[model samples]
Target: MDLNRVVIVGASLAGLRAAETLRNEGFDGEVVVVGAEPHRPYDRPPLSKKLLAGEWEPDRIHLRQPDTFDDLDVEWRFGVAGAGLDPSAGILHLTNGTDITYDGCIIATGAACRRLPEQSRYSHVHEVRTLDDAMRLRAEIADGGRHVVVIGAGFIGLEVAATARQLGNDVTVLEGAPAPLIRGLGEEMGAAIGAMHEARGVTLRCGVQVDRLHDDGVLLAGEDGAEGELIEADIVVVGIGVVPATAWLGDSGLQLRDGVVCDETLNALDVDGSVVPGVYAAGDVLRWPNPLFAEEMRVEHWTNAAEQGAAAAKNLLAAAGRGAGAPEAYAPVPFFWSDQFDIRIQFLGRASADDAVEVVLGSTQPNEDGTVKFLALYRTGDRVHGALGVNAPRWVMKMRGQLMEQASWHDALAHAATLA
Candidate 1:
């Protein structure tokens, strides 16, 4: 297939970067970016942090320079989403009653925030996924007298809780798990995080279930009782999680599990495990095998999306026989960071709940300033699997390189002992 045009669906970080990479890789073919949101690509991390706190304006979160789109030489189809894909015919149907034929297509639609079932019926219910969500949340919580309730204690929810507290509002964090962030960071670290919020005056209800959402508040249930307590809330923020935005591809013949299933090369695969030529996926919408972990995972970090977008672009060129040689497999040592209150939490590599966590430096003990600083190594058997650093950037930076080198558990522990 002669490469004449490449259409990138989803005009966010991944899509924009992929378009820039294609042009850089010497693919002068026509490029098009389609987005459901009317705005151009903007940074998302701030939506939960600075934007939610009202520390930064909406215009400050843009992913690119003001003149970037004008120079990209690509057609922009904003406010219209990709409704369907006819992969066999190499055509993409748009929500605006238009179709685009392409030699290559990159799926970067990303993910949407998961909302509670009762959200639609309540005007005060919100989820922080887009800029508008943050703007509304920030405005709603600006009044210090409002009682803000945050459902879920994940990064986003915790960030919102912190910001709401900063705005002088009474905040309560509801987590069904035994501890905050237990599903992601395990019990020890999750408890440490819970302590941080507690010190900041954010009430945490852990190991409790929210039975239902009322017009004014939520009904809670403890371990033994079905209707336990009612917490009054003027504003409710749901940060349960997100699901991949792949509903449009239901009949597109591509494998869709949690995300768009791709092979090691980031090329979309069919139901038979065969490559679906001319179709690739990147960002949070992509599930590709990482050689480093020997497992297929979809990463939602900002860094992962940038790296995968560029990798997908190169692979797209190579797949079309328009590049120098075979493309490299998309394998990256995953890393992500979160800032809550005064602590900066950084993580590198992967670690499951069963992995052994050994704190090598500082302490998870709360300080006078409601901060906990620590550096921990996560390992299973003799291999170092992951590392977590709280308020310890230098340690995380060094361990990241060590993780990429696949440092042995013994050597990593020895090095970590020095930091202790």
Candidate 2:
């Protein structure tokens, strides 16, 4: 196997980490990282929290500095995207009419924020995903105590609301669902987040549909009937969710079902088997098979991208016989955290599909400083599949190890008793 010419698409968390991991794993090959964004790879997690709160600037979120890429000897190709792929020729077709041949290829193309309906001025509607988006959002919100209408009650929306509130502005969250994060966290757990927002002086309006965005405010129509109420907000932030960035690979022969489909090894599932021999995928774009749940899953967390990128790098090296041993499979516990209005909400594992649940730690007010809540321990008969913790970072971080090691629920319960 020749260790030469590895091309990576999307200079995101996954793409940057993949490049770094390749160099770290002793891959002295020709590495090229292509990004659609003009700027280098940056941390997106803080965009909604610290950056919006005016605590951190846009440039501060950059993960790797200018000199770092040069030090890594990476051929940085910014402001260009991989338009097409010729698998037989082993060439990546760039949008700007540039072609690059590669021995191995990595598709770390991440997701993009789903846009809202068309408006007169698109600048009024904001979505946080990149440094530019965050900067623009922060600038609008910094105009001193202006009302902000946030659509969706997900982590991003809630975080933006928290930031707006911290800046002495009135914030209202309009969630189409009955409760916030009902799909992600079950009704019971999501209600806890809603309760936290209510206690923090943020108005939570559930089961309300946005008719349309007007000059004054959003028209509402739902169980409460149609009301053309003017909430009076300077800007509207929509955090409904994101769609995987894989439309460019439409001609690449890789299976795309809501996202790029991949095997447990992260190899792209090609139609002809030899379509993209050495091509692989990672991060939110790759709907890879998970061993723990025995199902193909797609994770859209920040950590997932970084970790999977490293794993994909190792797998690529293994395919080239440069790795020390067989690369382990990518199976994250699907945990993520959010900091909003002095509340740090954290989850250990996937709480999306839990049927039954129990409050293991704190029932209502678990901790004196803040609310510590842990939800339904996942189990198959008697064995625990995973554990989820809400508003408990230390607990979630601690349980992550247990989830990875397949620690028993009985022991977890025994340990929960000690925390009480």
Best by TM-score: 1
Model 1: residue 139 alpha-carbon error in angstroms:
1.1
lDDT per residue as tens, model 2, 1-420: 676889999899999999999999888879999999999998989988888788888678889778887899999999999899876578999999989998888998888887667744655778888888888888888865788899899888888888888888888999988889776667776788788888878899988788777776677763546464556667888888989998898987888887888778787887654324678888889888888767678888888898888888898788778898875677767777778776666766665555455677655444676655554455554445655666555555666666776667787666656655
TM-score of each: 0.97, 0.92
Model 2 regions lying over 4 Å from their true place: 119-121, 222-232, 272-275, 366-385, 405-408
Candidate 1 lDDT, 85-144, residue by residue in tens: 988999999998989999999999999988776578988888999888889888888768
**Could you say which candidate leads in lDDT?**
1
TM-score of decoy 1: 0.97
C-alpha local distance difference test of each model: 0.88, 0.79
